[model samples]
Target: MTETPIHPWNTPQSTSSSASTGLTPEALEAWVNARLDLHHQALNRVLAETDSRTPGNTLRPYDDAIFELAASSSLIGLLNSVHPDKAVRDAAQAQAQKISQVVVELALNRPVYDALSAIDAAAADPATRHYLDRTLLQYRLAGVDKDEPTRARLKELQDKATLLALTFSRNVQEGGNTVTIDNPSELDGLPPDFLNAHQPAPDGKITLTTDFPDYLPVMTFARSHNLRRRMFLAYNTRAFPQNKQVLVDLLAIRKEIANLLGFSNWANLATADQMMESAANMQAFLDELDSASRDGAEKEYARLLSFSGQSQIDACSRGFWLEQFRRSAFDFDSQSVRPYFPYDRVQQGVLATAARLFQVEFHPAPDASTWHPDVAAFDVFDHGTHSGRFYLDMHPREGKDKWFSAHPLIPGIADHPSGTRIPEAALICNFPGGKPGDPGLMQHSDVVTFFHEFGHLMHALLGGRQRWAGISGIATEGDFVEVPSQMLEEFFRDPALLATFAHHYETGEPIPAELVHKMNRAAAFGRADGVRTQLYYTTCSLKTHTEDPAALDLDQLFHSLYTRFLPYQWIEGNRMYAAFTHLVGYSSNYYTYMYDKVIALDFFAQFSRSNLLDDPIAMKYRRTVLEPGGSLPGKDIVYHFLGRSQSTNAFANWMNEQFQPPSTI
Candidate 1:
């Protein structure tokens, strides 16, 4: 297999202006906005043309034109943080979002899809025909097959869903716990940095927020079990006041859209393009997992209950007890590891890992125009030619969208390969900020998260033969897109890989082998609970999608369905479903995580049974899976990589082993 060219979207380029080369954020934004407007107008004119059925040969030009418009507009939105004026940034973002919505609508309209189909049928070249067919399928799956009225309704639903998701995330971000700790002794065992970050009022009461930096340390290390319970409840109940209604409406809208598109339910509609093609198949998979795991989860839960000093298990006690047990039993804790995994070191570790695995290079690029000081940019290069550049932004700030993702601003397309180097692609996360006494340190889990998101960055940066924006890296099957990232998480546990980066912040000592051993052994400690939680989410999502919107009690139904796995006497107001972002973002496709995990675990098995840092194996994986983009089916990619059908049995066995107590006990 030929090595793909390093596209500008994947590598970082300098945004700074020099006397030799003229480029400024202000100038770039203005030029981009003008270009976007021109392209938008051109697309509108073409779409409005009396000759809607353009010939196949002519479609490439039209498609290229439309893609350029969307790409430019979206990139401007992403880069708008450079705009000094808040109003300018807001206005640009709104316009860009509007253009994006319109582009989606155009792609999903029947006439546009018919035109693409005609193009596909008439194209003489095999590659051209394949591209057109793939494009046509995407449009159809996006709901282009619907009639005019339904299409209009679908657009409305899409817009509403977008706004609702944004709203829900905002509420969660702003909502945090305001703890009034009367005794400083309650803070015993908590990290000093965490305590320093939050200050007490005149009455001598310290406050805590639901933010991961604040909440995670408290939950993991605080001596007070009652405080941990309070924090857990607060974190879990985010956006509850309004999110319940938002979820209900969102579910109803999705169900209606799915029904209109000829699917039995939203799950079927959502999973059509995924490895698991139907809700029935997903449920069967989950059921098989439950059957395999029922005894294990119960045993773990009983052990946890006993550890918590509780005679009876209850809903609120599970999280608090789990953390306590994990710390006490394993002599391994997130707090103990956090000091060793500084944020900057973690970032370096991830980049270094990617470089070794994929033969790519990353170097920091200074740009004062970034949204925040925490946001850093990097340039990526291919080892062979050293010719391509892409940018990385790795921090969360106010007004920016909340989540972790690799957003490709410039999508690689066949026709527009060298037109405009999409200057930036980014991985955004909400990690803790640096402080005076302590530079921001991340837990081992956070280190894994850093690696996971960079897997997405690599996927986005490594542009394939195809260049269309819509069918780029993560634009593939929602179910399948996670495979690359999930596969990367395996690297976190690799001692060979950790030897390169994992170090103590104060003394710069390497993470101890004994700790690594305990970590590996305790790795499966809460595997059953994690899997069960995921299953509950998948079940709740399917139930919401498959049911009648008007007839359903959304909250009540979700609680009832998910609690089936819960032991009797646990309260119904677990309200976790209310806070499930996947129910909105993934819609009926929460099963993707499970589906992707099967593939990911299978992929991991290839390396786990061999050297984790085996370059040849990693290269084969990149070639077969990461480099394909959406040019081929995900199953084909998996089959090519693994040389067998994807199976969940190994995943089940892994979960069971994790839940099993140490033989020493």
Candidate 2:
């Protein structure tokens, strides 16, 4: 394999910017508050130091100080989301709003923007130029070009928006509702282990919570439609009523901000500088994908309907029937394969796969302690030397984000006197962790999710090499950001890789080759409903964000979108958007998941051969695609790596194949 270039911005590092271990609740507030103070001081110093290039410009000091503050803030933020102690979490959460407020204030400061803009950056290093350009874009996006009063209003709006988003997230975390199943008969088709592990209510009935472990299996396996419907409603209705007004206020504020920013709508404003550039472009992209997938999706739906032997379908019962159909057709039972994928074995496989392909090693970071016992630390070594570190906070509890993701905690920087700044990241997920004395086991789909989140973590750990903290580590455009995670799906699908670590937790036996083959063949069985379901989310998001929020009913919009795009009958009284946490973080960009899958597939075509774990291709991919982050345009990076422009042909074919006859594939 050819050696990849060690960019000056992210050379292999040996030091962590975090204290990492033993931060108590009492100290947490002081530590985080002090960091915020330092951040404000650094911003003021940067504004005070520079005016023009007639004299020498020296904002590097400002850059260093700000990044140091960012690193600390990231650690604090990570804790707030997943820390075991409620008090420490409370302090971090309190400090977070303050940090975001300060960040926006400094970023939008006219004097600061002017000072940075005045520097002669044309002749500077690429990273320096990247820093200058990115900073200016952020300032402009924050409304730095507005008049003083307008800017002040925008500042207030910005702070309110930040607080509102935080509020939206917190409501979901603390307010999610749970259900108790007082009837054992309601657990039909559920695994024996599930039944054995979850104790019945005091009245001798099984209890089910809306957590993924409880909710997903019932949706996908339980034969009782009434039970499934109850679970679905309870899960979908979480954070509702409370989040309903929150959404209304948030959408109105976003609209106001967009109008103030000289855009027609919030979607346009949000996508202004992203790869899509406007909501219209994103809509066009969605329209094209939907059109291409419609025929295949229709065929798949017909097959499902026929096999289901039911007159109609709904969100709750589709997965149950689909799994039934899959078993009858492909002779595969997904649940039966679970024992071969204990959570520990799956984690090993994921890390081992990365180690072989990317030439990185992961070792226990006993010193890099975290707030939660569930969170495990790993020191990352590249080329036999310590380069960076990241934490894995697998399994969920109350107050944690429901979805799976890798959050960047610190950016990797080179040539610092404190040794090369090591990148840090955290993987937050909710998989099935059985109660004490029972092993945590994962389904195949959960394994895929693990691989997907690992992609983001790897992107952060390896590609975080940037001189500027603002544009480091998976900071690619929103429309293309899902590519890395989606591309990792290709590896998980390879049966050869699956067999490498898949062994029965009790029997110590390898998964049978026949089972692997059956699973792979049925992998794309749900593509139609998956794609159609995404369309509802993406289209609803765009319309909700761009249209007049006051004139629309959140529930009505959700029902209409579902009825239009999905074959399933919409359930009345369900407020999906109210409980949709993505609406806060992803907002108008939910479509990117489908949009980037096209690009991800196109990228995956480069490694069509059998061995996905090959080192050379992996190294090339790391250098050309991962390391640069968003410093270069996504289009440029795609061309550099593939030697051609990206197109949607690959994704179209992949979607179509699912509906075709088995022999056709």
Candidate 3:
């Protein structure tokens, strides 16, 4: 599902920009209030009118208006997470809940629901039909079908739930805890360059924030076990105990909502609108993947214990030991490969590959103002015709979100009064940034992340032009949304694509082909652990939503799952679920990560049959899987693209091969 962004962007040229730099906190606050009121007026006109064809009386116009709000609210949401100005960030946060509540209320509005329900979507265009269809489904899912009291209660729960979700995410973003390093010797065994860049504290004490750049280095390479433990505990436990209650309340509320919605549990209600259809099916799928992945995870953990000669493996020591084992066993070093992946060079490669794949062009928009100095905007074009634009915010800083993602805020549609609508998206990440002289370098894994997000961006760019705003761009089922991104990751894993841009930064030398081969060799080192970790979360997600919260012990449930699946022993006081922001939007849906991987690899299997850059195959993917967006069911899209349904054969084989012993026959 597309996450609603918390930040704003420059609106389309035909419309006024909702958010830009140099706006005061008061101005932002007033604008959000006024904008929401304006949105209500526009939507109220639609809701009040009985005829679907009258002015402001159709699904398309309603969609266009709500999406305008979505664009602005998401932009503010993004700014709340990453904007440097605390005042602006604070303002964004302050007004976010209000906007969220408004969105929920709008979905719950009876008049709007009745208006959409009265329309006969059967005779509408395919895209319009899709838009009306999904909107009606969303309305029912939003509890519009519930009787008055139940619906009112659901609204209350929704309001609270939205706040909780935002708070949980904010707690994580705020870094619930930070580890201070008073002794410089504790940083030993880490790269000298990283130390020099991160160490700036007085009294010779360096501070480590739980941000990925600071915390990951310490976890992966720090020699001191205590320091590593500290970092791990800090990272895992962030927003814990506090978010624990919030999560409990959130889960309990969802349970009630589900029961009211005529479902057995929250998971049922959540998946009713998704491709999974039922919790049982989701559990069965996860169970199958879990059973297959467990053996490899166990073997790898045992290997780690034996390799380090340690009695037990904890979360903190896992990364540090994994690095040591990878170096000795596979003869591959992650840091050593970094010199070839400076962010700037990698960015170019991604853009070039994207342009080539889509037969599109990108020109940097120098005069295009951004929310931040670090953000770069580009005008996208296809075959000399304007497509849309996108913004990239790639560097890490205090208060920035810790993960990578793409937000397609302003959707592309053609029915606007101002001619064809332009799709606009933002790509956000927290990779380490460079200083004045030196440039930032990313791990190959990070490059894969970039590719994955770019795939989503391209999906938004190419697919969002659906005639209706509601049915545009990457709007497919949550299970199928990651298909293209995952397929793109396979492109990165390809030796051919890696060689195209893996050139050394300083020496201007191509990466040794040996490095890429070793990467593939060690790819399974943490495969089981990673997969199992996600499974653990999925199980918890299912349990929390499927079962009665009053009868559940969340901490016990979390620890039990961790013990059952993970290599590391669960540490006390580390409430990982609190920081699991996916619980908000993707509750009972964490399995999509693994489930989508199978589909991704299956789709990539098609490319493997021909050249990686086969134009025919690429165009087929773009036209069928990319262009239709949610106009067709995900299954239909895949069938149209590949001439058949995707199967488990390719994914199962890939997993078995990855987990099999290197000397396997």
**Index of the highest-lDDT prediction:** 3
lDDT of 1 by residue, 291-360 (tens): 8767887888788877867677555555556666777788767577777788778877888888888877
The estimated TM-scores of all candidates read 0.86, 0.93, 0.93
Candidate order (TM-score): 2, 3, 1
Worst 10 residues of 1 by lDDT: 3-12
Q: Give a tens-digit lDDT track for model 2, residues 1-665.
A: 22211111111121134333344555665555555666666666666663564112445645765675567667766777776667667777887887887777776778777777788776777657766776678689879989989998988988888888888888777766677777787888988878887778678877677878888888988988888888888988888888888889999989998999888899998887677889999889888877876777787788888888777888778788888888888888888789999988898999999888888899998865465566788999988878778888888777776767788888887555556777888898888773476677788999999998898888877877776565577777777788888888878777778889988999988888778878867767777668888888999889989989889788778888888888887777677787788889888888888888888899887884577787477788888888887667788888988899888987876776665577745
lDDT agreement with native, every candidate:
0.66, 0.78, 0.79
C-alpha displacement of 102 in model 3, angstroms? 2.0
- Pairing residues by index, what is the TM-score of model 2? 0.93
Q: After superposition, how far is residue 487 of candidate 2 from its true place, in Å?
A: 0.8
Q: Candidate 3, residues 1-665: lDDT per residue as tens digits?
A: 23223233332321234245565676667567656765776786676665545222577558766766776677678778777788878888878888888888887888788877787666667666666777789898888977889878888988988888888888778855788888888889887678878675777778887877788788888999999888878888888768888888888888888888888898887777777888999989988888878787778888888999989978667789988998888898788888888888899999998888878899999877677777889999888888889999988766677788998867788566657878888899877554576678888788999999999999888997877666678788888888888889877766667778878989988887777878777775777677787788889878888878888897788888888888686666677787888887688788787888878888888874336765578888899888898777787887887788777777666665656666641
Clashes of each: 11, 1, 12
* Over 4 Å off, model 2: 1-26, 50-59, 65-69, 659-665
Pick the winner on lDDT between candidates 1 and 3. Answer: 3
